[model samples]
Every structure is written in structure tokens, then in C-alpha cells.
Target: MKTLWIKLLLWGYAVFSMAPLLVMLLSSFRPTADIFDDPLGLPTGPDLGNYAKAWTEASFSTYVVNSLIVVVSAVLLGAAVSLLAAYPLGRRRFAGRGLFAAYFISGMTLPAHLGVLPLFYLLESLGLIDSLLGLILVYAAGSIPFNVFVLTAFFRQLPYELDEAASLDGAGPLATFWHVMLPLVRPAIATVIVFQFVPLWNDFFYPLVLMRDESKLTLPVGLTHFFGEFQNDWGTLFAGLVMTTIPLVVLFVLATRQIVAGLTAGMNR
Candidate 1:
């Protein structure tokens, strides 16, 4: 009876959590008049035209490409840079290594708003403002400190004997890392990729600050264009919103098991 009640509660919670998303999905198939007439009613008939109009009219295709480019570039470069920085911090015992590690970790606690003024000026001076490259750089830099911390923690837990044995076998630092440590850390890397990529893909603030043109807007920013002060096209707006949500939903579905396993793998270590 207790187990049945728990399952019932879980089902109820799932329904409550999914209510908004279900509404949005249903609204996408509704005509504007039907949406206003019956906000919560099941769609009497399905309409695919709203999605087509939302895609073409709102330039969502462009937004998707822009988002993909920014996210992929940032995650790839950020992960690579972090691996390089983390390995040394985790494995080496140099003078001031603790200080350096603290310095990097300190960035995690610092607020982005505090640095926004200087960052804007710096980007403007470097001619990076209003460019996708600028957004990518900002995302990559923001993610680096945390990624380094995570990767470094994972690396430190690794057996030193493995590295020492490799050294005995005439392996240099680079060779040891590429051959020994990296392969062992694949799950952590997957975890980091999932962790970093989702936010980068969904980020609205950096792109809003740096991208001025409509063509360059990412999905989150692009979705905003559907709202007008005078009137809101709730149907099309909700349709576009549904479109924005699909990619994230798909990614989570595909990576849910990996994310869980990776998280526990790190914890177990």
C-alpha cells in the first residue's frame, strides 16, 4: 500500500510538472481563435500550418544554426582548454599550485554582473561585439573555471601509480595524458559536455548583449520577437516555444542514462 501510494504521488507530480509543456504542445496545434476561445480545451483538430509559419516567419532555422555554432565552438574549445589546465593542476606539485587552483576556483563564486561593465568595454575595444565569435568566447571563458575544477577533481582521484608506470615505460607527460588519463575520464568528459552544452545552447544573455541583428539571434532571443506590446500572437508564439523546447527534450532523452551514470561514477570515485 505504501509503495502504491508513492507511485501514485510520483505520477501526480509528473502530471503537474508536465502540465505547462502539454498546454504549450496542444496550443501549437490550435488556431489563434480557438486558443483564445478555449485555452485549456483539447484541440478539436490538429493544425500543422502553425509550425510551418513559425519556422519560416520567425527565421527559426537561422536561429538554430547560430545557436549550434556558438554552443559547439564554445564547448569543444572550453573542454580542450580545461583538460589541459586541469591535468597540470591535478597531477603536478609545483610551487604555488594550490594558489593557482584557488585562483581558478575563485572565479566560480564571482558574479558575471560585476564584470559585465569591463567585459563589454573589452569586447568593444577588441572589435568582438555583435559577433557570434564574441559570444562563443564569452561562453567558453565562463565555463572554463568550473570545467577545470571538475576535471581536476576527477583527475586527482585517479591512481598515481598508473601515471608512474607509464613514466617508467618511457611515456612523457603528453603521452601519458593522451593514452592513460583521458581514456579513463571519458565518462566525466561526457558529463561535462552535457552539463556545458545545454546551457551554452540555451543561453540568452550573452547573445542578447552581443548579437544585434535579427539574423544572428539564438532560439531564446528569437522567441522573444513573437511578442508585441500591442498584441500577442499566443498561438504562433506558443508554437515557436514548442519548437525551442524540442531539441533540449531530445538531448535529455538521449543522454539521461549517460548523465546519471557519469554523475554516480564521479561520486563513487
Candidate 2:
């Protein structure tokens, strides 16, 4: 009875969470007057005009390109740094290992919002403000803490015997890490990639504060511009939201199995 009750509760929560998404999707095809008349009502039929209008008016093309650049660059840079840094501590262990790990992990406790002024001043001095490269650096630096923490723990699980064999065959540290240890933590890498990419893709805080150019705006910021310009255009607004949301859903679906494995398997080790 208790198990069944728990299952029922979970299902109910799932429905509650999905309700808004369902409404938003329906509203995307609806007319502005219809949305106000009955916001919950279903649209008359499938209408793609909202997407076209939103795309043309919102400069979604530029936003997509900018988002892709930042997200891809950040993910690659963050993952590489995290993997290299974590491998030494997790696999090889040295003096001050614990201190180094704690130092990296400490970044998690320091919220980015608190250092906005200092970061802005520093970036301004370097002339990196309002540039996509600057945004990528910020995103990569922000991701280090969590990725290092998780990947470090995950790397600790990889068998020591593998390392022994690699070393015995005259493998150098870099080659061993590249050819051996890295592949073993693919799930963790995927998990961190998905986690970091989702937030960065939807991120508005850093973009709003750091960037001034409309041409360099990401999807989330672009949606803000769309909303500000089309305050009463519910259909187009929802369409823009739908566009922003689809990528997240697709990413989650693609990486769901790896994410589950990483979350479940890492901590226990």
C-alpha cells in the first residue's frame, strides 16, 4: 500500500510539473485574444506562423550562433581543465592533494553574483567585456567547481589496476590519462556536459551584466528582447519559449542514461 501511495504521489507531481509546459505549447498556436479569453483552451489547429514571426523579429539566428559558440567553447574548455586537474588528484594523489581539492571545490560556495563588480572591472581592464570569448571564459570558470568535484569523485572509482598496467607498458602520464583513464569516466563527462550546457544555454544573468551588444545576445536574452517588444503578443512569446525549451529537452533525452549512471554510481565510490 505504501509503495502504491508513493507511486501515485510521484505521478501526481509529474502531472503538476508538466501542466505549464502543456499549456505553453497549446498557447503557442493560439490567438492573442483567445489566450486572454481562455488561457487554458486548446488551439483551433496547428499553426506555425508564431514561430516564423518570432524567428524573424527576435534575431533568433544570431542568438543561436552566439549561444552555440559560448556553450561549445565553455564545455570543451571546462571539461578539459576539469579532467586534467581531477586526474592528478583523484588517480595519482600527491602532497597537498586534499588542500587542492578543497580549494577548487571552494568555488562552489562563492556565488558569481557577489563578484559582479570586481569581475566586470577585471574584464573591462582586459577589454573582454561584451564579447563572446569573454562570456565563454566566464562560463568555463564557473563550471570548474562542480565538474571537478564530481569528476574527481568519479575518477576515484576507476580501477588502480588499469593505471598499473598502463604504467608498466612505458606509458607517460599524459598518454595514460588520454588513452586510459579518460574513457573510463565517459558517463561523468556526459553528466557534467549536460548539466553545464543546460544552465549556460538558458543563462541570462551573466549575459545581461557582462554583455552590452544586442548582436551578441544568447537565446534567453533574445527571448527577453522579444518579450519587451511584444508584451501583448502571447502566442509569439510562448513560441519563443518553446524554441528555447526544445533544446534542453533534446539534450536531456540524449544524455539521460549517462546522467543516471553518473549520479547513481559516483557517490557510492
Point out where model 1 deviates above 4 Å: 1-4, 44-46, 168-170, 229-231, 266-269
Candidate 2 clash figure, as a count: 0
Candidate 1 global Cα RMSD? 2.3
Model 2 residue 3 lDDT score? 100
Q: Per-residue lDDT for 1-269 in model 1, tens only?
A: 99999999999999999999999999888888888899998887878878887777768678888888888899989999999999999998899999989999998999876887799999999999888898889988998888998889889989899988999999999999999999988767877888998887777777888789888888778767655521366777777888878877887788787777668875655
| Candidate 2 lDDT, 137-225, residue by residue in tens | 99999999999999999888888998899999999899999999888898999999998998899898999998899999988887788
Worst 10-residue lDDT window for candidate 1 reads 223-232
Q: Name the top lDDT candidate.
A: 2
| Deviation of model 2 at 142, angstroms | 1.3
What TM-score do all the candidates reach, one by one?
0.89, 0.93
